[model samples]
Target chain A: MKEEIIISGFGGQGVLSMGKILAYSALLENKEVSWMPAYGPEQRGGTANVTVIISDELISSPILNSFDTAIILNQQSMDKFEPKIKPGGVLLYDPHGITRAPVRKDIRIHTVDATEIASDMDNSKAFNMIVLGAYLKVLPIVQLKSILEGLRKTLPARHHKLIPMNEQALQAGMDRVK
Target chain B: MKGIHLMKGNEAIAHAAIRCGCDGYFGYPITPQSEILETLMEEKPWESTGMVCLQAESEVAAINMVFGGASCGKKVMTSSSSPGVSLKQEGVSYLCGADLPCLIVNIMRGGPGLGTIQPSQSDYFQSTKGGGHGDYHLIVLAPNSVQEMADFVGLGFDLSFKYRIPALILSDGVIGQMMEKLRLPAFKPRATEEEIARDCPWALSGRTGMRPQNIISSLELDPAIMEKRNLERHERYRKVEATEVRYDTFMCDDAEFLIVAFGCAARICQKSVELLREQGIKAGLLRPITLWPFPKKAIEGYCRQVRSILTVELNSGQMVEDVRLAVDGKVPVGHYGRMGGIVPTPEEIVEALKKNS
Candidate 1:
């Protein structure tokens, strides 16, 4: 199966890393994957996004005008990507600073309040993981084992201690996503 | 080193250079591609493999450092985006004229001026038709994937040395900033002093007691000498064009329509071909891996099977000139592109094709 996912949020909201981890997890499974980021002034306070494609066959385009799933965090992303999701695709988002909710009825829309959840957990940095967890729960495209492996490959060894916490956050997301 | 590791295209370039026994990397960090320098600095190839990584004061300085390294027959390179590359044009021209073997990586950003920090193919004319000055060509290799980003670092050097000419990895921001799984290349040991002396007989290394001094320069007082030098380089260019032309044809067997693109544009067109096929349109894609050789013959060959051709690029229209020249009116050649760093969608490409057809 081929899945095209776009994750967009504020630059510091870990949007790019969320896509990177997902792409890496897919790579560990020997899936052909490509991750293209919206690299620009977005690195500051602007909206940042990344397009990730995972497939059994080699990926053709990393940049796309549409996606099978769009994981949005900020309202700008919701305003921008809500219309771009393919019909019957997945729209998983964190309803934290989002003034405008996704209006698309063709795709599945699920909110996880990842920011509030992470704050409740007393780990603000886990906000992205929580959102990612919600995405995996809705799609289940990649397994937790692959995700943990992805974290190992991505994070420096000194920070591997947080992997278990991230796994827990992933579990909470799966449990909380409706 | 056969494992598949996920990394950005820029990071892959850095690791590839270190593993490929690159002697030195002289560069100033620039956006979208600054990761190349950052990764190299973090890896500290100096401690591990004795490879020197220096952040030169500017693009001009870095390129001249490349010149110094190439003069001594050392494997060296520098990378930058479009504006930075523009600043190095004079040095690039000198390297081409001196017949020095070195790698130059341009992870291109949008341009006419410092257009934007976005990916663009506007530099196609600059890269293929001699951006700097004079009648010189860089063995231009356009990579569309992270794998090719790793693979080309070593391949670019080999081709540059083999032909004694500068080679360019003409990539764009999308390819450089994008991430994909890469099968890491095995480490190659740095060339030994004896090996360098033997392999590069024309090197500007210190002289031995028995031989005359080896001088490397692009300057000449006499017009005849300069013309002769230019002619000799042209002869090598012909050889490169004949022997080193590389391209890929996808689903072209029964295609009635064709799309020709390089680098990232090719990737998008590949999908467009698939989408077109779903609509029962017999479409195919031809990707030029070597932009300099232009793949004129291969493109010309496709004119027989395909009724018409569309050249897709990120710029308004740069590579289309070459594509049209290659087609030679055998079939209609149309151009589709977006300017100012906007990438054209596959749907837009299909629209362009239908309109053109």
Candidate 2:
């Protein structure tokens, strides 16, 4: 199966890194993947997005006009990317920064209060992981074991101690996705 | 050593240069390509491989430094984006005139001037038709994937040294910034001084008692001698064109229409080819990996079978001219592109093909 996904949020919300982790997980599964970001000045406190494509065949263009899934973290991203998701596709977002709900009826839209949960866990950095966990819960495109391996590969060894905490955040998100 | 790793195209080039036993790199920071210099700086190859990585004051300075290093027969290189490459033109010309071998990478962005720092192939004319002054040709290689981005560095150096001409990797912002999995080549040590002396006896290393002193100069005041030198360079270019032409054809066995593109545009065209095939349209892609060599023979072979051709690029229209020349009016040749940092989608390319065909 091929999954063309876009993850968008504020520059500091780890939107790009989350896409990198997803792409890396696909790599761990021996799949063909490409990760492209809305880079340059747009990456400085502005609405940033990354396109990640995981496929069994060769990926052609890293740039795309539509996506199979969009993981949006803020209202700005929701407004920009909601309509871009393909019909019957998936749209997952955090309600914390969303002012207006996704109005699309054709695609699946799910919400998780990732910010509040991350705050409750007392780690602001876990916000992205929680959202990622919710994405996994909703779609299950990749295996959880592969994601853990992806996390190990993407994170530096100096931060290995935080893996358990990250796992807790992921589990919390998976639990709260309903 | 034989493993896959996720790496950006810029980082892949840097790593490949180190692995290919490049002796030195001189470059200035530019958007979409800064990662190349940054990665090299972080690696600090000087500490391990004794490879010199210097950040020059400007792109002009960087290319001139490349000239000096390459004149000594070292595997030296420099990289920049569109505007920065424009600044290095004079140095590039001088290197060509002196017949020095070096690798120059243009990870291009949008341009006519200092345009957006987004992916663009607008520098096709500058790269293939000669951005520098004078009548000289660079061995230009366009890489579509991150793996090709890494592979081309070694191949570029090999071709450059083989012809004693400057070689250019004509990539754009998209291919330079995007990330993919790649298996890097095994590490090769830089050439020893004795090896350099043996390979390049004309290099200004030092004069042995048996041979005459060597001088590296591009200045030729005498027009007659200059014409002779130009003819000699053209002869070398002719030989390169005969032997170094490289291209990739996708699904062209029974294709009725052909799509011509290079670098990043070629990758998008591949998808368009697939889409067209799905729609029962017999379309194929001719990807020119070696742009300077132009892949004229391969393209000409397709001209007889394909009813028409569409050339797509990220620029207004540059390589399209080359396509027309190659086809030589055997079939209709049309052009489609998106400039000013906007990349055309695969659907858009298919639409253009349908319209043109």
**RMSD (CA, Å), each prediction:** 1.2, 1.2
User: Per-residue lDDT of B1-357 in model 1, one digit per residue for the tens?
Assistant: 248888899999999999999999999988879999999999999998899999999999999999999999999999999999999999999999899999999999888888899899888888899989889999999999999999999999999999998999999998999999898789999998888989999997678756688889988889999999989999999999999999998999999999999999999999899889999999999999999988999999988888999999998888889988888899999889987888888888888888878
What number of clashing residue pairs does each candidate have, in the order they appear? 0, 0
Worst window of 10 by summed lDDT in candidate 1 chain A:
A38-47
lDDT winner among the candidates? 2
Is model 1 an incorrect, acceptable, medium or high docking prediction? medium
Model 1 spans > 4 angstroms off: none
- What TM-score does structure 1 among the candidates reach? 0.98
For each candidate, report what fraction of the true interface contacts it reproduces: 0.83, 0.63
lDDT score for residue B331 of model 1: 98
